[model samples]
Target: MIIRYLGDSELAQVRRRRWRKVFYVIDDDLMRLDDDRSVPEDYRQRLLAFRQKRLPDILDLADVIVAPNERILEGYPSKKGERLDPCYVTVCDDLRHFDDYQTIRILFPGSRSHLNDLAFLQEGLLRLSAAHTELEIVTYMGANAPVRLKGMEQIQHRKPLPWAAFQKEQQRERFHICLMPTVATPFNQARSINKLFDCAAVGAVGVFSRGGPTDGVIADGVDGLLVDHDVMAWEKAVGFLIDDMARAKTMAQACLDKAGLCGNPVRVRDFWRKQLDI
Candidate 1:
């Protein structure tokens, strides 16, 4: 069996090959490209030509179809296609959770493209920062971060690092809470639970936007906090964690426990075997 992780050109080369082929669809390129207003004006045409046009053709040749998230699977053409039971995969690694840290650290580890989503909470974050001097706001997106947080004393904006150095960054400085604020756009809806997994890896309890990728996993107020994309709600959720250290620790541990189930390599291997009928 041959597996292609969103490699349209590679899959195209082996279209009529004898071996079984699988295509993993993580993003709906058509939806993204079509929503030109939401997407950057500069990247629209290029993305449409390549991702929108070239990618979907590979789906027709695939013997099996796999998607990391359910929403991604639902976007596929249903008229005439072989769509298998979707396998939700998590990109998690074995990293020690430093939950016993003294100070409260809040992280927003997305790229500059996520600036649009974070704009909603900029005002709330400013208020939260001013009220709580002990809270530390950390972000890799320096200039892309909320304008009010740029020069704040409590907030620290570090330069973005490569994927390989992510664990190292986590090791050097542990965070207590990770914030993920997403809008209800097609692109945002199809996002994976990557941020949640990242937080669980480093023993950070995540506060995610409800109806986003973390829906199936996070049990609000238990493992993680799932709230609406409102300013006050985000502020309140962060405040709750800050005020109650014991609860925060419990939730962080719970999140790690949930992460263990999703991130297990053995389980993933078994799932692949079953999917491939090996």
Candidate 2:
């Protein structure tokens, strides 16, 4: 799948060939190419040029546009956009459930692009970490993470790894809960539920933002918890799990079951078969 924006020669070559095209929309490039400050200015400018000149044509020529989520597909001008369901094959054998554990480890995983999202909910996270000495928050965001979470004894800052390395490494560590907070931005709105898959891999129950990506899908008090962006709301949502081990245990199992369904070998095989038309 051609996820990245193509160069001039590559575009020409693709245009010349009479082949089936599947364009994977990895990110909301239109929103980020110019505005994303995390990227270097020179690289951003070059990417913006490519996006402005070649992106429309790429979309126009694509036979299928594989979007990460329904929101992205809906916002996309192309009707060929298809939202992909994530399949998790790499899971940890021994998961540290909330039971028998004094410290509740909450994984707050994100990348450079998600700094703003983390920042938005930093206050709530700060309060939670401060109030609960037993609650530990783990993040792969490193020094780029929220300042509020810094210097906290419970907040762990792991060195960011490459995608492949991270996938393998994440399974090695055990987490009780996974925190997924999304800000209501165009770029964030277009994101996929990959975090849910990550939670599944580590056997952690998810606590995602209600109006964000987890909207309408996650059953409240069942597989996961859906919360608003409010400071108290986040604290309350996480605190519920921390206070009650039984509820957390049940939710973790339910969330694992849900993730199992998503990662079913036959289901994944069928999805790809249909998507690839093979």
lDDT of every predicted structure (CA atoms): 0.68, 0.74
What does candidate 1's lDDT look like per residue over 1-278, in tens digits?
33433355666567646665554434443544475345444545665676556556655555454655555566565522333322223322332434344557888877555666677778888898888877788878766566766888888888877766865666555577888887777767766666776777566788899988888789999989999978899999999988887788788888877777666667667776776678
Q: After superposition, how far is residue 272 of candidate 2 from its true place, in Å?
A: 3.2
- Residues 37-93 of candidate 2 have per-residue lDDT tens digits of 544356567666776788777876677667657655664664577676667766545
Clashing pairs for model 2 are: none
Clashes of 2: 0
The runs of at least 3 residues in candidate 2 whose Cα sits more than 4 Å from the true structure, single-residue gaps closed, are: 4-17, 29-50, 53-57, 75-79, 92-96
- Scored by TM-score, the top model is 2
